[model samples]
Target: MRVLSCIVGQHNLWLVLLAAVVCVAGSWVALRLLLRATDRHGVQRSGWLFLAAVAAGSSVWCTHFIAMLAYDATAPVTFEPILTMQSLLIAIAGMGAGFWLALYNRLPPEIGGAIAGLSVAAMHYTGMAAYHVDGVIAWNMNYVVASVVLSVVIISAAVGATIRGTSRNSLLIGLGAFVGGIVSLHFTGMTAVSVTPFVTGAPIADATVFATMAVAVAGVALMVVGTGVASHLIDSEVTHENIAALRHLAMTDSLTDLPNRTGFNEYLHFELQRAEQGGRSLALIGIDLDKFKEINDLRGHEAGDEALKTIGRRLLNLSRGGEFVARIGGDEFAALKRFRNDDDLREFIQRLEEALFKPLTIEDLEITCGASLGIAIYPQDGRDAERLIGNADLAMYRAKADLTRTVCYYEPQMDEKSRERRGLAMDLRSAIEHKELELKYQVQKSVESGEVRGYEVLLRWKHPERGYIPPSEFIPIAEESGSILAIGEWVMREAAREALAWPLPHKIAVNVSPVQLMHVDLARSIHEILLETGLPPRRLEIEITESTIIADKVRSLDALRRIRALGVTVAIDDFGTGYSSLDTLRSFPFDKIKLDSSFMKEIETSQQARAIIRAVLALGKSLDIKVLAEGVETGMQLEILRSEGCHEVQGFLLGAPETFVADVVAVEERRIA
Candidate 1:
């Protein structure tokens, strides 16, 4: 009690209060650093824990001596150098042991508190022993024991708060308890000391040296805390960068570096919501390049990739502010734009064509490609992203089919037709397995004697519910969906097997789709079918369109030669419709030319049609290739064809393709009898 009264009366009050505030501030920062260090990598735990010890130990050591420096005991007092330094070593060693246990989560909260309390007692008493007053020192054993026990209780409270702390409030509570405990330990230990004054023989150590040491301790604490905070920030930034890179990879196309379908869908939906809330107009445009597959087939996939990259760059450059463009499929792209007026929409469409129509140069080869675009407007075409894209897709199909207009807007009727087409395509996949499909035959007759020379095979589908679906509606769907490959092979086997049972020596002609002509193994597959069915190759004929050969002339010609070498005849059907018919005929030899029915329809009304028919007949004679007239619906058309020396004819007038072969044979028997 006498020691407290003497120091309080003489000590500088301002420095004592400053020391108290600095203690709390320094301890808070050190605790934050310690927690962060412990949470980091285990392999680096010791390194970070060492830093924590530096920060924590220096803060406590500085606070204790700073308060001690404020002490004015009325007698000159100098600290013993060895004992002062030993107090600091004790502080650092104890902090390291406590932190190590806490970092590894090995000790209980109470046990950590006991360690901290014992450390405080050791450091405070050791530091007091350094204060040489040139007189004997006495201690109150009861107060000394009380100080130690009070430190235990206070430090225990701090440890409890720290263990339970996760948020700002709990952290503040923990810091308050810890700082209170340390300050209490110091003052209580001071109250236990009593000194007797005497005349000193030795001069007191300079006060300036103690002040310099105090500043050095504070600087070390600051450096440790600052370094830990900087590292944490850098690690956080690196983690964010890695996440962004992964997101970009997920959203972008690997080949063209454009937003893919998944990214496009998300962007479209975001724009749609914004436009809806603002009552603004939005447009979704679907674009598909014409004959892109042919480019890939003729050039190479690498060239195709370069072409696509060029297209993506061009489209990205052409996009206006608030507009987005993406590649949704191979050879297919899309654009979304916002507009306020019809003129703006019109101008956008015009610019789109100008940008897309530009030629692309890949590997020093200039390639020309045209794009077809379809537009669907907001609040008019659809209210949602999915419906809008679908409607635009339907309009794009119409634009592709109509040669006059390469860009068209959505119409209500197109939806119905598109839905029907989609439904038919889905159903057609299972049609063969269900036995819902069959082949009918139409007789091809000799124009002079009217003798049946061959029968053209026709596909007919009788749906269980829809009843008698027309070939014109479903055949094109099958071809587009790529289901025709399987259907075609099925037809060949069926036709060959049925023809083998026929009594007459007539050929059976099956129409081959352009898709089937692309297969290199078609000839080999057909040979296997003929052998399995026991049908002579001479009795089966493969009919293809001129467009098929025009697509890939060399490949088509090679495939045709291989099939013809099997003794199967190859004829060109719908001859005049394709470009360069005569050139095709000259380059590739065909067994027969079925004149397009447009001439047969025109032969009655126009002399030009008759003249063309005669010219074709004359050309066929010169080449020794037979000419046949298709779609001969009237006697007048048949008579005109016969007069023009057409060797064979087949149409509705003579016979619509019969569904049953037995009926056809019975009719032929009656006519012959």
Candidate 2:
């Protein structure tokens, strides 16, 4: 009751309000600094903590002095300079220690708050001790104790609230508690003072001096607090901007500036959930660019990248309401959409196909790009993102396999085939390891004399339960599954080793897959195999199709050159089928050209086939390269090939592909005989 009477009656209302304002402003700044400090580490955290301490200490000091100026003590008073400075120092150091304990040491907030509260009480009493008056002063011990206890409790609560979190409620509670603590402590402590004037002495200072001091303190306090507030606001803005930029980078493809696989997965998941709720169908369309690798190999990756950017921009433009597009992989993209009926879906797909199929100009070269699209519908195709994406991938591969189709919808049969392929892939790995694969040798002979020249090596796989799996069936799977690399190496090594056992030095021709030729160092592997098998390089011939050479012309030519340098012959097999047969011949110094069997199948019926054969034979002869006619099964074909001056012929008419090494050796012996 006494403290309230003294506060209400003796204090100037306006000055009291000013003191409260300063306290709250300073507390707000300190709280922000502390929160920022918590987010930082090491020296940066310490810097923020030091700034918080200064703001908090200056606030308490200014509030104490202002409230003292508002109090009517009826006697002139001044502050002792050294003691006043000491009080301010005590507050700053004490607060800093408290912050360090809570933040750096990872102590509880309450403990730090208690220490801060104690510092507040200590600062108040020390400032009181700095008070000088030309009068006799008496203190009420009870009021002093009550003032200390109340201030400690209130200020502790303030620190606890502010340090707890950066939430609005917490800040408000902390600000209120801080103002209340400063106000209550000053007024309550004032109630403890009783001043008796001396009879003859004049006062040392007047009210104007104290007013000036109060103004100075308030100015300094406001300036310090304002600086802290401004720094925090700027830092917060920068932090938010950095976070947004990092998020964008995480979800975006750097090259195309499109949503990448991570972003696609998130978008798909969200769409699936929304579709479930809205009871609407969503389609996840998977698009894989056909022959994209060829583009990379031929035009260089820069042109390929430019092509992708053009495609991404087109797809982005095509996307409208309920449509989302993303580039999910290299040469792969996806689109998400919501549709009502089949007609709407088909119309959208048509637009997507048209947009993708359009020609793109990259690096001043006009190129036609095509995409194979696979769609998996919601609810029916899959219930989740992973399953849906997988189904769409299977459909995309299916469309890719059938050149006649560019768009395919997910079907159950596709899943069965995928599972079968995966099982076969696993089995193929085991087959290689267990030596379950066999090689067959087919005889190639001179068309003029029917003299044996060399034999072509062929790969054959016989499954344990399924009996024989033809090359046509499993070769594509091997290429797709990337097992072709291992298979190619195994076949090369086995053929070279078997040829080393030959009674005659007939050339052994082994076919190489493009995957193996481009992906691995084929020349080095061949050199190693020859050395390991002790077979002469002249007896080894590597047969590659024109398709392989065209896949990566530069690399393919370089590898071929290296093989030829090592004295191993290089042949372009199935030559007439590829679009670039003449170009391939000009690109590399091939030892032989194997006429595609397709031309042989049509030779008897088609005049065009015979003409093409004749042209290729003339071209090969003009270039001083031998031409071998493969699949020559009849006398008519042989006679025609001979009349055309074909250098070699291989067919079932000369001999069937022999599985046993002894049979091949016996045939060679018979031919010699």
Candidate 3:
């Protein structure tokens, strides 16, 4: 202990401490650089590894010689050039190995730590061997072994802390490990040595050694900082690219690679304002693909996606100068087109139709999909974006509803109708909740027996102020507004319950909308309703339009089969009015087919209608399915249907729809008499 105190007193303590500080600062900086190098993505990171080796190696070498100057030996102390140079090379090689283990191989920190501790021990012992003294020196194996062991344990712990700890904490750990290990090893090694006086020998000057090491340390520090700066630039570039990609994804549709609804709305608003100031009119053409749901049903969704992409490409091609095209919804698109004259606008519409009418080929199938376009002019239709878009949507629906019209202009009457329909839909929700809807029964008579077979349940709604609203008006409105799900369920539950109180053994036929047929759990709902009403499945018939199955054939057929499995019969209503294929009847197991009312109106005068009815009846006969003719209002029409061998008939001629069942047995007896 006295020898250690005398040695510390002999040298300049401040310079010794400053050297230790430099050791810690250099080590911390080197560790940070190595960490940054490993974090970087590519080949450019390798430069930091070399920088770490140089900084860490130079620090240990400088710290050792600086402390050696404080040795205070009797003879002058100097370093052997070859041995000292070899120690520096050994230190660099050891640091390189430690870095490779921790960064490249991704070994646990303890393993890299052990390697790092051993590296420092090797450099320290090798530098000690380079000591030139004019005395015979003896080493105590106990102290020498203790110094090496202490270095290994303390340096390893420091390396481990630096590796495991966060960035800010790592610096403190690195400083402790590097400077602490160097000082501790040197003093412990000094304790092991006993020097005996002998002949004097010349030594290297302290001033020259100190100046050279200070310059070396400064060079290593610069290298580490430069590498760190280069790595920061690379990371910044990568961050910029990622941000740009995110922005593009936010505004663009991934499926079609076109502007999405948000992007479309932004562009539309800007264009609308530009047109208003310039005194030029702009057109918002809202486009809806007709029978798109059918395509999705007939083909899978994958094919449907391909069809949408194809449509987007075609629309892009048709977009003229100063026009913007975007896909706003599923099966819906919008275009903002500017025009100088009415004739140019008409020409653009004609060109758009020509482009869309062309067939799209997808995976061996050629699909001919048509589009319905609704044009809303700026300033005339609306002043704001929301109003313009809403008016355009209403016009699109109007064009879609009429088979002959492919395009329709926004009319003020359409908005009034839309508002009325929306108001009716809102009221329908309340009506269903309050049980304001009524189910009227229309008798279906057997043509041959003149007996009432069953009654078709018809929905009726009467507004408080409007008196009575027709089903044709409110039913469609309810459907479009998605209020039909609740209303339809109520109708089924009510009709099934009402049948239990009727005096007649007549089956109740409840109409199912296309939307209602889309429910996968329709069978479960019906089962619950049957359990609630205590009505047998045999007495409940679900009548679906041909359009219902045409919308989503697989799903609707699955729903029908499930319902039929519950012992209830399924019938196709308004059959001929829809695109009913004879194949659909063969494929789907329908128990009955109700001929459309339009066919019956012409049956009295037109032989073509009569012959068509005969063919349908013949088909039904061959298939062993009952064919009921609807809308038999005139006696002559009933007679014509009878001659054609219609199985059942329902119209005002037989009986009108009555709110109450009204002693149904008496009515049947009266009809028979």
- Top candidate (lDDT): 2
* Candidate 2 lDDT by residue in tens digits, 1-673: 8888888887777778888889889988987798789889988898999999998888888888888887777776777988888888888887887777667455777677767777878888888889876689999999898888888788777777877755779888887887787778888889999888666566545667767777888899999899899888888899999998998999999888889999989988899999999999999899999867656765789989988998998898988899999998899999998999989889889999998899988776676789899999998999999899999999998998898999999999998898898888888987887767999999999988877899999999988778779998899889988899999999988888888788889999999999998789989998998889898999999999888887778898999999999999988898888656777888788999999888988888899999999999889889999999999888898888888899999999888999978889888788678
lDDT order of candidates, best first?
2, 1, 3
Clashing pairs in 3: none
Q: Which has the better lDDT: candidate 1, or candidate 2?
A: 2
Candidate 1 residues 1-673, lDDT tens each? 6546644764556556656766776677666766666566775667666766666666677777877776655456878999998988887787777766655556666576667667777888888888777666788988799888887788767766776577878778878888988887877777777767667666654556545655565566556556656765675687689889988888888877888898999999998999999999999999999856656755778888878888888888888887788898899989888999989888888888887788877676676778899999987999999899999999998999888988999999998888888899999999999999998999999999998989999999998789999988888999899889999999999988887767776899999988898964789988999999988899998999988887788888999999999999988899787656898899888999999987887899998888888888999999999998999999998888877789999999989998887866776678778
Give the number of the best model, judged by TM-score: 2
Where is the poorest 10-residue window by lDDT in model 2?
197-206
* CA-only RMSD, every prediction: 6.6, 4.3, 9.8
Model 1 accuracy (lDDT, Cα): 0.81
- Global lDDT of model 2: 0.86
**Candidate-wise lDDT, in order:** 0.81, 0.86, 0.80
TM-score, each model? 0.70, 0.84, 0.63
Of the pair 2 and 3, which is ahead by TM-score?
2
